[model samples]
Target: MSTLSLRGIVRQFGPLRVIHGIDLDIAQGEFVVFVGPSGCGKSTLLRIIAGLDQPNGGQITIDGRDVTGTRAAERGLAMVFQSYALYPHMTVRQNLAFGLENQRMAKEEVARRVAEAARMLQIEHLLARKPGQLSGGQRQRVAIGRTVTREPGIFLFDEPLSNLDAELRVQMRVELTALHKRLQATMIYVTHDQTEAMTMADRIVVLRAGRIEQQGSPLELYNRPANKFVAGFIGSPRMNFLDGQAVGGRSVAFEGLPNLDIPAARETTEGEAVTLGVRPEHLAFTDGAGLPGTVDIVEQMGGESYIYVTLANEARLTVRRPGQTQLHAGEPVRVAIDGAAHLFGRGDDEHAITPRRLP
Candidate 1:
């Protein structure tokens, strides 16, 4: 395991600067994930770390040693890519042994490492199977096994499960988590999927337009986003946003509705243009405690249902409820917002706002 640090990292393609100056400190054995929309320079940043691409300006240090000008081969890192780059003709064991062979490792040592990796991955029975004979999940596992045999100081995964089906992705996520526990190596994962970042990362680095938008734990970004973008990006079914003006400290005058008091103090003064944010699960159905809305759609998912309701102001809202609950489209309902609502100033900076309680 090793510590990885980047200071003033910058990447430019022609006149277009893709990655702006970024700084990060990754502790040894920490599992950090970089997540953002496509074209956000996440992949570019990872490539810079692996020495696959040199940064325009920055210092990269691994284990306290500067490796900014180092070659990828000399970086002492194992990378598992999205496309399982396993040789189709080679069996699982041969594929795992190939890297060690290139370094002129003893045949016995190579075999030992391959055997150990196979056992760890529970693919011992597939040793003789070629890539063509394995399923997508199996191929991905072989790719990971190849990395395991290298036993590098760090492991880098670039959306390794994006090619798999939903079920396989979930299964592979569990396996990857277990693998991390067993190896305890520093890992940096890159993905656009928020769920993957939320579930797997010790800390998530949310990027936008080649810049770091936010960096924190999943819950932190979800519950207290730094801006409207972070708040909307980190959650499933996303938080609802409504245009409003700050009525008082932590309270906003929601359009067509009474003054909604937020639970926290507003950083800005009254009458500032702001957007109110409330998560779907925070909404409760009440007789008259909530803003009135008519259901537009309801999606049932075994254990829970997502009710899509359009409010009087024409803003769409989704409310999550137990699966047994019945809410139909075209039905008028009052959905109450909790004291946990978030507010974002017009400048897009996240502002602290207090949520008001109902009578």
Candidate 2:
């Protein structure tokens, strides 16, 4: 386990600045995940940490050592790439032993490490098989085992599960989480998958436009997003944002719905535009008047259903309902926003209109 810190990290390609000046601190043995959409610099940041890509500026320290210029090999970090970069000619045992051999470890010690890693990954029986003979899941485990035998101070994963099937991805995610707990190694994983980040990370770092939009525990980010972008980004099915205007203090009227309660502190200069942010799961199909809409789509998932409603103003909202509601397309539906639903200053997209101070 080791701590990592990045100070004023910057990465640029010619005049195109991809990673803005960023600073972050990662605790020893912490499982941190970097997640964002495509071209968001999550992978670039991970590469910088692994010493694969040199930052245009800033300092990177690992375990109290300023390893900013250290070679990837000397950084004492092992990286698991998305491609499962196993040698085609080598057996699983050989692949696991390769790194130890490069370091001139004794044959007996190398064998011992390989055996231990295989057992840890529950793939001891697959040792004699080549990469071609292994399934995708097995291959991924081998890739991870290859890193494990190195006994690296830090482990870096770069979308290592992107290549697997959906079911396999979920299964591998569980295995990886368990492995992290057992090893208690400092892990920094980069992925575009929110489900992966939400489920696996002790802390999730949300990135956008080369900046750290927000960083927090999964639930914290989910329940109390810092801004509109985060509110929409963190949740499954996404949060719905509708055009609204603060009519007066502590009240905001939706364009096509009744006035909903706003935090008293929400700045409401006459006709000040704002966006009302409500999450699908936080909303309920109510009997009383709420946001009136027509059900546009219904997705049934056995025990639950997702009702996608399109408001008269053209804004779409998704609501999670219990079991299968006899909802069909064009059915009249009303979704009551949880009073605590977020409101944000429309143009700036940062100001949270909800009560800044919680009771």
Candidate 3:
């Protein structure tokens, strides 16, 4: 296992800077995930860590040793790419042993490592098959097995499961999580999929346009996003935002709903613009007066349902219900914002204004 650190990590493509002074510390045996939208520099940062790309500035440290100038091969790290990158002609066993052989390791030692990796990955039976002869999931296992054979201090994965179908991706996610637990190796993963970050990471770093937006545990980011961007990016179906005006002190009046008093840390002047954020699950259906809307769509997902409604002011909101609902399209519905509502100041820099409440 290894502890990795990055200080003032900067990357530039000619005149255009992509990574701007990133600073992070990853503990030994920690599974940290970098997540963001496309062109957010998550993959670029991963490449810098893997020594595949050098940073324009800043230092990379591994196990308390500076390795910014070290070659990738000397970094004692293994990376699995989105593409399997396995040699089509080479069998799984050969692929797993190729690196060791190139390093001129003893034949017995190389064989022992290959055997152990194959066994750990449950790909022993497929060791004799070439990449073309195996399924996508099987090929992925071989690729991971190849990395495992190296027994590196850290493992890096760059959207390794993006090539698989949804079901296979989920299966591989569980497999990778179990592998991490079994090996207790430091792993850093990069992906645009928030689900992957939420499910697998001990800590998640959310990047945006070459800058760190937020870095925290999944629930921390979900329940208490620092700003509107992090709040909108971290959750599935995303948090709903509605325009409102601060009536006074802790009272805010929604555009099409009654005024409600929420816990706000800062005092707001009367008639100040603010955005109200409420997750789908945080909005409850109420029989009495509330935010009036017309149900536009309903998505039934086995045990739960999502009610999509258009409010009087044309703002759309999705309400997540625990069970199947009889609510249908064109039906009138009223939703009351629970105490879990988040309040953010409206502007270019939309920071959260609501006090953090216990979940």
lDDT per residue (tens digit) for residues 1-359 in model 1: 98999999999999999999999999999999999999999999999999999999999999999999899989899999899899988998899999999989999999999999999998999999999999999999999999999999999999999999999999999889888988898999999999999999999999999999999988888877888888888889888888888766657787887677665435657788888888888787889667888999888898988999898888788887766568788999998874367777777455434333333
| Collision count for each candidate, in order | 9, 0, 0
TM-score, model 3 to reference: 0.96
Alpha-carbon TM-score of each model against the true structure: 0.95, 0.96, 0.96
Q: Itemize residue pairs with steric clashes in candidate 1.
A: 250-354, 261-355, 261-356, 262-354, 262-355, 262-356, 263-354, 263-355, 264-354
**lDDT order of candidates, best first?**
3, 2, 1
* Residue-by-residue lDDT tens digits, candidate 3, 156-219: 9999999999999999999999999999999999999999999999999999999998999999
Error (Å) of candidate 3 at residue 345 is 2.2
lDDT of 3 at 219: 91
Which candidate wins on TM-score?
3
Poorly placed runs, candidate 3 (over 4 Å)? none
How high is the CA lDDT of each candidate model? 0.87, 0.88, 0.90
RMSD of 1: 2.0
Candidate 1 Cα misplacement greater than 4 A, ranges: 348-359
Q: How many Å off is the CA of 70 in candidate 3? A: 1.6
